[model samples]
Target: MDEAGLSRRGLLGLAIGAGAAGLAVGAGAGTAAGVAVGRAREREDAESAYAFFGAHQAGITTPVQDHLHFAAFDMMARTTRDDLVSLLQDWSYAASRMTQGLEVSATGAVDGSPEAPPDDTGEALGLPASGLTITFGFGPTLFETVEGEDRYAIAALRPRALERLPAFLGDDLDPAASGGDLCIQVCADDPQVAVHAIRNLSRIAFGRARIRWSQLGFGRTSRTTAAQSTPRNLFGYKDGTANILANDAASLDEHVWVAASDEPAWLAGGTYLVARKVAMLIETWDRVRLSEQDAIIGRSKGEGAPLSGGTEYTEPDFATTDANGAPAIDPNSHVRLAHPEHNGGIRILRRGYNYVDGNNELGRLAAGLFFLSFQRTPESFIRLQRSLSTDLMAEYIRHVGSGVWAIPPGARDGSFVGAGLFA
Candidate 1:
């Protein structure tokens, strides 16, 4: 433990306890030599990697990695169940090896016969595992389409919670990017490591499936555990200062993990993943006055404290009024509307990332938060988003891309991913 009576990993959480907590800049590790040594140990640890076999997938509760490569794919027309199963089996084998920093195949890279193409892409050949985790999910369409066609003959297996997301206010969804038959979320501390995982997985998918769309992101916007510091969004405010921590077993069981009782037993220990590509109007926001910006977010830009309160973590005095009789924390502020107190004590585990994908036609930076959240049911996200419809931050952002997928329970050592679906 540190001098503060908190473990080295608890610094960020301590800040949250302080209220008005967001992120602590430069909080962990010390000195160049110390950082170097720490990183070396981390590299060794990363090489061993998180086990791909578990009761639940790793990335959902794992500490949010620094980089992300999220992809959604659609099975090719006429793709058979056998073809899909084969693809899943191959992917499972490859993922198990790659997570341990091994090449995807024994004939990996240059080891494959010269007469044949290399098995692994080889970009990550010399890299450590870098804490890479790849999680896969199935979309509603994967079970049955909106037209009521059971394309995959697995419609009966679909969870009642896996239906299509209802159109929400201010959604400018792009159909090409909004839905997918399958989704893969690859996250890692190393950008190359994350990308490499997706690249090879796409290769394995080959004829069975094709990429519908993908998003690249960096700088995680939330911490999944007390071990991590809260990160900032492109808006420069601390994002998810009071987010659900991985160590909060009670919260995980209640809000994030799917129970056998939730139905469709194949997803018992799994969860639902909702992805939203929220494009922030950065230029407009930058031009706004600082005080106005703080008002919009309901937190001080500098301290991240509730406008109504003492510290960032201070329970917002929602009933407090100003001298003129206006509510202290604006009723429309992002934080006020999204807070669990106002939303029936509902909360979602956020694991979003900041992204910049060049400039738009008007030359404004095409950047925003790639909002990702895992919950026991899609209703959780829907409820939160519906409450945010009146949020002050809404005008400054647009939801352009979106998806919802039912992540299956993790595969055991001898089984392939999603093997239960087939069974």
Candidate 2:
């Protein structure tokens, strides 16, 4: 049958049949059993060109400032769906074994890319990002199972975020229309480490499945700058000055948490949104003076606080009038343009990382953010960027990369990638 015409139900049926046969080997048993099977497969089908053994060990590491971010996706032949599912089941089992005993935070979801009635279970899977650093992986149901000869996609994100988890996991954001199947982020002190992590993950992913496409990202600096350090956008003087903060649990309940009234029972424990952008341009940015730069950004150079006068994270009254009764914060200022609320209100949960690259021909360094955000909707995030693109900072920064992903509800055992897509 044509790959596109094959349905997920058909693929699942195939996987169930194959899974029963592989039971003599117990392919779907558990992580421990899965690892043993995975090792056997690696040895039997071992191709020297694809070093599956070494690739497996490259998945874990201690906290480092610079770490690699890698992603890969593939299409499965209808006939091979069962074998593929068995293979992935084993791979996940083996991988978890290798990284055993480490404080790893993970979430798995099926493809619920298309909208469905909310699952009404009150049980909450309190996967909070407070104080604990963690990375997330997203596997669509179709991709997870050995199904039809259909194209299945998987997206994994590393680098855990305590402050940014709400936005990254929130459901209001849609990623299918945005063109990305997987997303991964990690924090490494060194750039090389980040690249190494990404490359290794790609190897494992490609080694097991067929990879259609991939990409990587690096950050400009390891630390957040003093001036542009709002919770959402960077400091370019007035950047993200008008952001909202879930100051109290009540507010957090209102903005960050998904309403129990709107989602599925399984989805009850989930937050959904995946906001991502690829920002570039720094060479031209460095030449501007501190004073001029501050004026353009609408804040002091040393601190990211508002230009209307206040400390970092403090509120700025945008409505205040100047001597001539004009606006105290210039309407065109970066912050003013991005957020005019002035109380340091209107916040977003930012979970982003940086990337770097070199052009051998030009002999120059290319770097910027692998920007990701999770908000309730596209409206607030869109408004902020729209302000930036038309304002003064636009002259220095250009959005070279962009995508949006929908982070669906997590999954139970045996059900593979994006079960939610059809759920």
Best-performing candidate as measured by TM-score: 1
lDDT tens digits, residues 1-423, model 2?
Answer: 222112122433454455566676665654344345444433332221111122111111111223344443443444253444554444434233222311111322222333642221111111111111113233333334323223432212111211122232112323321333344343333333334334433444444444433345433222222333343233333233333332334543444444446433322323434434444456666778876677577677677766677786676667877688977667777666656363234445444555555542565446555555544433446555644554776665545444433343333444432344334
Model 2 alpha-carbon drift over 4 Å, by segment: 1-178, 187-201, 207-253, 263-266, 273-277, 321-326, 340-346, 360-364, 387-389, 409-423
Candidate 2 Cα deviation (angstroms), residue 59: 15
TM-score of every candidate relative to the true structure: 0.90, 0.54
Alpha-carbon lDDT, every model? 0.86, 0.40
**lDDT of the structure predicted as candidate 2:** 0.40
TM-score of 2: 0.54
Model 1 regions more than 4 Å off:
1-48
On lDDT, the leading prediction is 1
What would the per-residue lDDT of candidate 1 be over residues 1-423, giving only the tens digit for each residue?
A: 122221123433443443332223343323333435445555554554888888888898898888999999999888888988998889888998888888999989999899989999898877778788999999999898777877767889998999889989989999987889999999987788889999999999999999999999999999988878768899989889878888899998999999878788889899999999999999999999998899899888887788887876677888988788998889999988999998888889999999999999999999999999999999999999999989999989999999999999999988988889889
- In model 1, the worst 10-residue window by lDDT is 1-10
